[model samples]
Target chain A: NAGVTQTPKFRVLKTGQSMTLLCAQDMNHEYMYWYRQDPGMGLRLIHYSVGEGTTAKGEVPDGYNVSRLKKQNFLLGLESAAPSQTSVYFCASSYPGSQGKETQYFGPGTRLLVL
Target chain B: AQSVAQPEDQVNVAEGNPLTVKCTYSVSGNPYLFWYVQYPNRGLQFLLKYITGDNLVKGSYGFEAEFNKSQTSFHLKKPSALVSDSALYFCAVRDSSTPGYSSASKIIFGSGTRLSIRP
Candidate 1:
């Protein structure tokens, strides 16, 4: 199994450009999340989906949108890319319950640059 | 609100010596704690977690974490430091009652701690 896979491993976009980062997981997890990693800031949640066809806002959802139309796919979109939006994006999923039971599994990550 | 704190920005250890990366959390009610490690240019990898049962939790790569409920802390530890272990570590937490933890809560991560192993 491919665990989790993120597409567009690297991309560069100009300000106001639009793009979408795709994340697919074979784990059949009910939860999926998008996070951005900035220097010195660790990882901050951008958006999440609790199940197929459901999505919700996260801590840093200002410039992003998400969709989970399929059970295995979660997509994060940048409608208008800004320099501040340039960072490494990660996708994670987990099975909730027990301690250590919900350890989130992360994707390889997608690096985006906005100039 | 649930949050986590990694007090040290960086930790240095001599190869073969024990290593520790401190973490503390703030949340009402029971807390689910987790530790993750990130290597250069890669995604964060699960190191360990503390949900319940024993206070000491063993995880991948010979790493473990001690959950001290009284202290609101979950510290990651290893018997020996390896140069290959040098990387960024993060602590995360979520209140057990949080909806996100059930079907809606997203994990909140700490700023991160950079660990270095010196030969």
Candidate 2:
């Protein structure tokens, strides 16, 4: 099974452009997350969803929005891209159960370049 | 507030030698700590985690980490370093009972540790 898949592996956009990054997981996990990786910032959370129809803000949610319309899909939307938004974005999912098991599976990632 | 710090920007070790990447965390209550490794231009991969049960937790790729409550640290360790082990390492922490984690959870990651194994 495809653990996690992110669409638009690479993209280049001029400033003020709009785009959406899609993430899908087949594990039926209840938790999904979006993160961006910069040179020295490591990975910073952008947005996340617990399940279908549920979404929440994360550590760095200023320039993005998210939707979890489907249980297996999470979408990140950039209303207006900027040079600061040029970074590798990752999508991840996890299963949190009664046993306190928290293992996150990640997608390859989308590399975006905003000029 | 929860946060993580990987003091060393880069660590170099000879192959076959024991390797250690340091990490420290700050959080209220019990912290669920985690270690993840990333290859060049790749997503972070889970290595191990420390919850309530044990201070030393073992995970994939012969990697392990020790949890020290007194020092508020969870450092990643490997008995022997390998060329393939060279990668970017991250430390993360979260409070299991934090209000922000009631639904979809978010984690704080350390700056990152670049481990290089010299032949």
Candidate 3:
């Protein structure tokens, strides 16, 4: 079913460069999320959307912006990439309700390196 | 605010031996706990969850976790560890109170513990 897929599985960007990471899911889930995993820091939420048109800030959303223009897609954009933003990004989706009570399916993840 | 803690940074065990990964949580109301496993360079995989039921929750790969409400802990356990079980494990929690649904919708994850089962 291709539960979740991420585009540009690996990318390298120069300082000040901009790029977008795309996430798509065919599960028809109502909730989508963006998270970054770093060494010793674990996984920190970047942004999330409850529905097609609603987006909310997560634990660490400073250097990123997200758009949920379509139900099956969620996009994360970095206006200007920095070394601090280099990390493995993961996209997840789940059914509606309290997040802890539901199962979140995650994508393969994109490895971004900003030099 | 809801939070999760995995006290151990790494856990080592021999194959065929019992293993345990500790986890503790804090939330305003009732807490929904979860466990996820991640392999090298891969996304997190859902292992199991505790919503409302028996304290002993069994999950995939013969893994189980015991929920202790009084101690506010949900420790993952396996009777016989396998070499393939070596990976990163995460503990997460969220509040179940209706009044805190907005904030509770967010799952707070712990720092994660690396499990190494030697052959």
Candidate 4:
């Protein structure tokens, strides 16, 4: 099973350009998340969707939007890319529960470079 | 609010020696703690987690972490260090009090710890 897969593993965008990063998971997880990893700052949540139709803002949701049209897919969109937004983006998914069983599985990552 | 911290930015251990990467956390309710390792340019890989039962949780690759409520720490440990074990480690935590039904779950991660196992 392709636990999690992200499209456009690498992308380069000029300032003000817009693009969308797609994430898909074969596992029937109820939770999907988008995160960006910076140099020393750990991964920060960009946005998240708990189910197929619900989305929520996360710690760093400012330059991005997310949609969960299908249970297996979560999309993160950048309306206007900026140099500050250049980072490695990750997509993850997990089961929904209060117990410790909800371990998030992550995709390789998408490297975005905004010039 | 829930937060996690990894005090050491870099940890160097000689091969065959025991290794410890420190992690501490603070949460409103019971802490759901986790450990993940990231290679050069790869995504974070789940190592282990502490839920409810055991204070010492063993995970993949012979790594383990001890959860101490009194100290608010969940330090990752390995009996013997190997060169292949060198990588970046992260500690994450979430508030267990958050309702399970809520779709908007959030987890806070520590900055990260770079572990180097030398020969």
Candidate 5:
């Protein structure tokens, strides 16, 4: 299985431009997450989906939106990209469990640069 | 609130020397600890985790971690360092008080520690 994969591995956008980052998983996980990695600031949660058709705000949800239209896909949208938002974005998936399935599987990551 | 800390900003070691990366955490309930490695221009990869039962947790790449409940620390360790092991390491924790199905089962991560091994 591919586990989890993210599309558009690299992208550049103007301050007002908008774009979407797509995350897909083959593991049939019930939970998905979007996180941004910045220098000296570990991964910060942006948004998350508990299951298909359900999404929630995370620690840093500003300037972004998320939709989980399909069980295997989770999409993160940048309404208006900003230089401050330029960071490596990572998507992860996992089964909602207490014993063994909580180990999150991460994607290769998508590098974004906003000017 | 639950949090994780990696006090060392960077750690350096010789190829054959033993290596240690320190990590500490605080949680309201039982903690599910994890260690992840990130190479340059790559995403974080799961190395190991400490859920329960064992005080010493073994993981991928011949690495291991010792969970010290009294100290609230889970330090990653290796018997011998390899130059190829140079990378960034992150420590994370999830508070077990939150139900597994809740969206608030957030995993908090440390800022990260850079490990460099010289041949």
Candidate 6:
């Protein structure tokens, strides 16, 4: 099983340009999340979804939006990319309840460079 | 708030020697700690976690972590290190006492530690 897969392993964007990052998980997880990894910031959540058709803000959600139209897919969109958005983005998914609470499978990560 | 700290920015150890990566965390209630490893340009892989029971939690790739409630630390250790063990290690924590599932269930990660096992 391709636990979690992200589209466009790498991308370059200019300030103000908009793009959507696609995240797909085949594990049939009930929770999905988007996080950005910076040099010294570890991983900061941008947005998350508890289930399909449900999305909520996270620690750093100001410049990002997300959609979980399907249980297996979660998409993060940068409406107006800024240089500050240049970072490694990761997608993760996990099952609900206590069983899978501590374990989250992550994607390879997408490296975004906003010029 | 919940937070995690990886004291060392990097650690160097000889292959075949024991290795330890220190991690400390702060949480209001019971802490669910975890360790994750990331290779160059790769995603994070779960190593092990401490929810309850044994303080010494063994995980993937021959990794183990001891949870110290009093010290509030979860340090990753390996009996003998391998060159392939050189990678970025992260320490994370989550508050298990949180009533129900929400964004509060999110795990907080430490800055990270670069572990280099020299051969």
Candidates' TM-scores?
A: 0.95, 0.95, 0.96, 0.96, 0.96, 0.97
Q: What is the lDDT of residue B68 in candidate 5?
A: 98
lDDT of each: 0.88, 0.89, 0.92, 0.91, 0.92, 0.91
Query: Model 1: per-residue lDDT, tens digit, B13-108?
Result: 999999999999988778888899999988899888777899999999999999998899999999998999999999988777755344345468
- Locate the minimum summed-lDDT window of 10 residues in model 5 chain A: A95-104
Candidate 6 per-residue lDDT, tens place, A1-115, comes to 9899999899999999999999999998999999999998899999988889989888999989999999999999999999999999999888875732458889999999999
For candidate 2, list the clashing residue pairs, or say none: none
True contacts kept of each: 0.54, 0.57, 0.54, 0.54, 0.48, 0.52
Give the range where candidate 1 chain B is weakest over 10 consecutive residues by summed lDDT.
Answer: B98-107
Q: Pick the candidate with the highest TM-score.
A: 6
The DockQ score of candidate 3 comes to 0.61
Error of 4 at B113 (Å): 0.5
Clashing pairs in 4: none
The digit string of per-residue lDDT tens for model 5 on A46-113 reads 99988999999889999999999999999999988899999999999888765332778899999999
DockQ of each: 0.56, 0.58, 0.61, 0.60, 0.56, 0.61
Q: Residue B35 CA error for candidate 2 (Å)?
A: 0.5
Candidate 4 RMSD to the correct structure: 1.3
Instruction: Please report, as a value between 0 and 1, the fraction of native contacts recovered by candidate 6.
Output: 0.52
Better of 5 and 6 by DockQ: 6
Candidate 4's residue-wise lDDT over B1-119, tens digit each?
A: 67898999999999999999999999888888999999987889999998899799999999999999999999999999999999999999978887755524558889999999999
Residue A69, model 2: lDDT of 94
Recovered native contacts, candidate 4 = 0.54
TM-score of chain A of 2: 0.96
- Candidate 4, after superposition: displacement of residue B63 in Å? 0.5
Assign candidate 4 its CAPRI class.
medium
Q: How well is each residue in B22-83 modelled by candidate 2, as lDDT tens digits? A: 99999877888889999987788899988888788998899999999999999999999999
Please state the Cα-based DockQ of model 2 relative to the true two-chain complex.
Answer: 0.58
Off by over 4 Å in 6: B103-105
